[model samples]
Target: MLEVKDLHAFYGKSHVLQGVSLSVGRGEIVALLGRNGAGRSTTVKAIMGLVSAQGSVRFKNEEILGLKAHEVARKGIGYVPEDRAIFPDLTVRQNLVLGIKDPRKRGRWSVEEVFSLFPLLAERAETAGGVLSGGEQQMLTLCRTMMGDPDLVLIDEPTEGLAPKAVEQVGEFLTAVKKRGISALLVEQKLSISLQISERLYLMGHGKIVFQGTPGDLRANEGVRKEWLEV
Candidate 1:
């Protein structure tokens, strides 16, 4: 439901995304695999109007390249940054409440459903969001975005820092997102998790997509993995 074509973004004349192109279909999980500085994050941010970009960012068959960030979000596209952004002062429940633009405009997610998915959140519903651990904060961020009820989400490194259990929780969370009929463009460094969950993967290098194929195709291409994926 999201398509980015020849997207190029700039940071004060320093070009980051060099003719990047990709797409995420309805209910499909597409992983953008790359190392730091590969422009994977820029691809998503540019699509969301967070960066100075010139290209075609189409959502649900409508072009949204030059729209403001909030305008882009209003069109049913949510973004979860690499560094978990949670309210420091608000309670967990209150933070989630802020995600809902309109309580009456119930889309696909609810507070109860989010709490059910992460009981820790339910237990700490009244607790201050800033006091939670890194993993808990990650869960909170993802849940809050779900509360917005977007059709597609751009998640940047959801498991960047966490214990194995929390990592697994994130995996389960993505599965639940798909179950709710939401697609995602996942920007991640972990190949194992992406390979396990994503139907297709795109590897970026030097600010460009170097490989695009299914999990099986990616797994079989050892050269591509070595050059673009391996540490």
Candidate 2:
């Protein structure tokens, strides 16, 4: 469903993503794994048009490299950044309402349905988003993105600082997304979760994809893991 070829991105002459290439099939979850500076997040930002990029980014066979971020989003892609960007003063429900692409048309997900996925959101529906716990904020961001009815989502560090239980909840969220036939490009640090949930994984090093294979293949290749993944 998504393909990136020779993608390059920069931050004021510091090239962060250099010739990165990968693909995500329909209804498939692909994990991008690497150390802190391996350029995983830059890859997604380039695809989303949040950064200036040069190369080919195609979703469903159409080039989307130069489109603006909002334009790319209208093309059925959602992004959940690592920072958990949510409106601090808005009520949880109100924040969710803002994610609706069109109020007149019903999409694949609803506020009530997302509330079902994370009951705490329903309980805190009227609470200010700034006051929620870190985990709750993360959940709210994920559900709010889903509220747009995206065909694919680019999630960056969904489990970064959460407790174990919250991490498990993230796993559940990914499973739910997969069950609904949504594609995901997951940038994650937890190797265990990535190996458990991803059908395929790509290991990045020095701003390029160094390995691409199944979980089993990654498991069997100790040298690749030690070089590109293990700390």
Q: What TM-score, computed on C-alpha atoms, does each candidate reach?
A: 0.98, 0.98
lDDT of each: 0.91, 0.93
List model 2 lDDT by residue over 20-51, tens digit each.
99999999999999999999998999999998
Model 1: CA > 4 A from native? none
Q: What is the lDDT of residue 8 in candidate 2?
A: 88
Model 2 CA lDDT for position 57? 97
What tens-digit string does per-residue lDDT give for candidate 1 at 16-102? 889999999999999999989999988988988888798788999999999999898889998899998899899999999988867
Q: Cα-based RMSD of the predictions, in order?
A: 0.9, 0.8
